[model samples]
Target: MSADRRRILRTTAQLAALTAAGPLLAACGQEAATAGGTAAAAGSGPPHPHASPGTPTVLTPNRIPSATPSSTPGGSASGSPPALPPLAASTPPEVVTGPRDRPQIALTFHGQGDPKLATALLEAAEQHGAQVTVLVVGSWLDQQPQMARRILDGGHELGNHTLSHLDISSMSGDQAYAEIAGCADRLRTLTGSIGRWFRPSAAQYATAEVKAQARRAGYEHCLSYDLDPRDYADPGAEVVQRRILGGIKPGSIVALHMGHQGTVDALPAVLEALQQRGLRAVTASQLCS
Candidate 1:
């Protein structure tokens, strides 16, 4: 063949080769992306003190097919936690617990106190492949705005615990409404929507009127626990663990608190005990579902 013809033939062959490899290269790129996404989703830190404090990736229910969509409002994505959707219908505005038929429990935290201790407890649960719920005081969220996102990012749930962590049950209706609504507004601004669950401050159970106010504020249910280890008293970790383990049963909701070193110390053992008993520690949403 003439030199010009040969050069043209070589160029044509190169073009064909490039065209054929394009799909394979594209496929490779896609695979890599998928793998990374999965790791980011699953590897959202050990929920320990060492977890990435800067916020981790958010995975929608679609990313986790086994996960039912948030029974309440708000979801998350990308950098900041994204509220999933507006509340279609109010969640049942009644007291609830995980069903007794299941061998699962919810380890719920009162969201306040030391950020580091809270982080430690969360990390311990995550290390054991458990997910817990944190009902945060609005004021606490204000001091640690990143914590709202951090809680959700750790494959956990974050909800309202009143704005000032005051005695909502004792307040007048209008006063109670402000406390609920105010905290809710903080959650909305930080994480896209007011979280699903609300727990009254200074009281384990909500009064009839407080429930009404919470419903008005948009929470479907006010959370209550079946067990209290009294970790809030800063009781030693052993006592906290004993109290919880003693009362733990299928579908039990254990009221725990953040910012206590004892609770943090007790959590890992409690998780282990649950695991050995063939019980799983999960978020309240997961437990209820």
Candidate 2:
């Protein structure tokens, strides 16, 4: 194989290691993507050939190769779709390819009201020189305006996680609209600009009703996770790190809880491991490009 192809293969191997270790605890969350099925972009790097592993770039994902139906029994009597060409060098960054060859992962935090934990997460990000995004509850902002302000002042991105966090899908039309729009309003007032993104509670978006609600509320897109650290459930630090490192792909929006202690414990390793892999940690919006 050419050197570029070899690098792609090595990268694919790393992504496989992540998956074998399990994903970031997204039990049933819909895959988060731009309208065009793309991952966000953060920075620039080389164009490697289509290899598998490490983490797939969300900005430009290579669909896992599918099996061909045979001419024999139990196969589609019809012919198969043509084999997908291998990923090309110089694919567009906005296309949501998996895992960056450059060191970078966007660290996402959920919940509000706990300034200590919030500060700790931010401090960790700063200590490691990683970019961070904090998704704050509207009420959380009310209780912790200083924390919210600190996040923005610290150069982190602050996003909306909805007011009251009622499951948008289960809510009535007006209620869903209120939940999303209310939060956006609060965030805009708190941070000046409107929130650039919206991530649903539990990473769930059950219907078009909720999707429309978010969009109408002025969100660019609903945020979902490709890797879930399961920090919310209080997984051990080691477990969280293992799951994230094993499962994360490039352009993956990793979900962790700002409300939980395990995530706080795990943050350092997560940052360290990312650095060791030459991945730079950034905010969700920056990754979205």
Which candidate achieves the best lDDT against the true structure? 1
- Maximum-TM-score candidate: 1
Off by over 4 Å in 2: 1-103
Candidate 1 stretches with Cα past 4 Å from truth are 1-92
Model 2 lDDT per residue over 1-289, tens place: 7999999999999999889756554432335543224422332221111112222111111221222223332223233221222433543322222346644567777756356877787777787888777777665554454555566555577777766555555666677777776666666555555556677654444366767777788864666666766666666888988999998766667777675667778889888888787777776655644
Clashes of 2: 42
Backbone clash numbers for all candidates listed: 8, 42
Error of 2 at 243 (Å): 1.3
> lDDT (0-100) at residue 71 of candidate 1?
24
Which TM-score value belongs to model 1?
Answer: 0.70
lDDT of 1 by residue, 36-69 (tens): 8897666442232112222212222233212222
